[model samples]
Target: MVTKTEETQLDRLENQVDNGGGGAWEYLCLIRKLKVRRSEKVLKHGLSILNDPKKRSSLGSEEWTLYEQVAIAAMDCQSLDVSKDCIRVLQKRFPESKRVGRLEAMLLEAKGSWAEAEKAYSSLLEDNPLDQVVLKRKVAIAKAQGDISGAIDCLNKYLETFMADHDAWRDLAEIYVSLQMYKQAAFCYEELILSQPTVPLYHLAYADVLYTLGGLENLQAAKKYYASTIDLTEGKNTRALLGICLCSSAIGQLAKGRIKDDKESSELQPLAVAALEKDYKQRAPEKLSLLTTALKSLKVSS
Candidate 1:
């Protein structure tokens, strides 16, 4: 007697558990389940597979990888006993593996053994000074322990070695922004823009940082980057269009205070105003308030 809503929910859960049918897909399902905090479902599906004698014996080398994934998910779910059992299986299978050793350190961190986790990470680094995984894990531990500066330092050191790691650069930039270190975050975005100029996100991000760290020069640069964003997105980027208007206003105000006859602002301000007004009129009637405000701020009467 399941209601339609209940049946739909069950179907979705089944789809997530099935997750497109493969070992790799199963791993992804476990990770996806962990992301949504569906720990009980993860335990139910994962243990059903691992507990079957035939399946457990047949997993072969993949057993260790499965155990590690399940162990981490179990730890997150507070199923410490299940996690411990999975970790023991992994430890027994790969006694000398540094990869398993990192998992051990992760378990310690999960158990709230911060000092021991740090020690284990340090010991691993001593064994091989260039282990990127261990370095990242140590940084994560530092962040979890509220050592913001320590985490930043560790990330900087890691980036020195892995300069082209875009994910690491993005993480570092976010950390810097959280600390209000706009210049450093801007540098990270600059590198991203240099590597992938066609990425509109990087251009927009760099423009935002420059606008936040305002000066005449920075505002001008922000305007240029915002223009690039608009062009890259085929002029459909409302935010970038607004950014152009705002930067033009800021520059005009600065010029009014310093130079009585500012040639650049005079040249750019009319063009910016015309573009914004045209877009504002073409947009949906419901969305005109924001564009109106931007136009008013720039003193563009329309």
Candidate 2:
């Protein structure tokens, strides 16, 4: 039971669709808003119109556009069954559609049908080997299913296919860290740095992975990366600063027995102090709190 205003908006939206002015984004926004307003009747009406191939062909540039609109609307409405049906229909109708298989897999994932989702994604990959989004999703699904090796395999496939993707390298490195494959994670980070030398966060991520791996010999390399991060970012980034402090503190703890009161070992303290001061003045309480904890640890350990 939509209010008059909601009904009027839906009418206007339908007019826009007829006029070829409303796109998938518009339809999705309207559907989401209508759902939030509890205007199920209006949504159902819109979905019916969108699903009507004759009406959809008369209104849109292509029938597949209408299918996408209905599928997205059904997903938004939490109508997983309808969403799956729409995707299946699209898969049959538009076998060559680039997004059909991916959408089907996503629908299956939404329904918590992991095995079916995996099959759908794998089938999609077989059809289109270069679909990076599907590959990334497969990695995430593998990780969620506690199949670390599968995740690694997907990541390796992605790397082999798209060697220059620094972001993918970062993601793969994070996955390696999760699997406690620190050495492999470090190598991934190194590749990421080579691809994107100016990104301080990469260096930080690399250092963090090394810190967790716990061999004192890795400290020098980790500190070098952290130092490069601080230098590249000119000490302005909070994440970079925090990484430097943490790496420095970890290295200091490991070296405490060998070098007492090393000035360079204490360098991280003042940088962390400066970072905290800036965060406090900027009212970034979350960063301030994190830095404060790291600073405290360094103080205790030093």
Q: Residue-wise lDDT of candidate 2 within 7-78, one digit each (tens)?
A: 787778767766767454455456656644433433465566665666666765555655665675566577
Best by lDDT: 1
Query: For model 1, how does the per-residue alpha-carbon lDDT over 129-214 read when each residue is reduced to its tens digit?
Result: 99988988888988999999999999999999999877678888888989999999999999888877898878998999999999
> What TM-score, computed on C-alpha atoms, does each candidate reach?
0.72, 0.61
Task: Name the regions of candidate 1 deviating beyond 4 angstroms.
Answer: 1-64, 74-79, 257-287, 298-301
lDDT of 1 at 240: 85
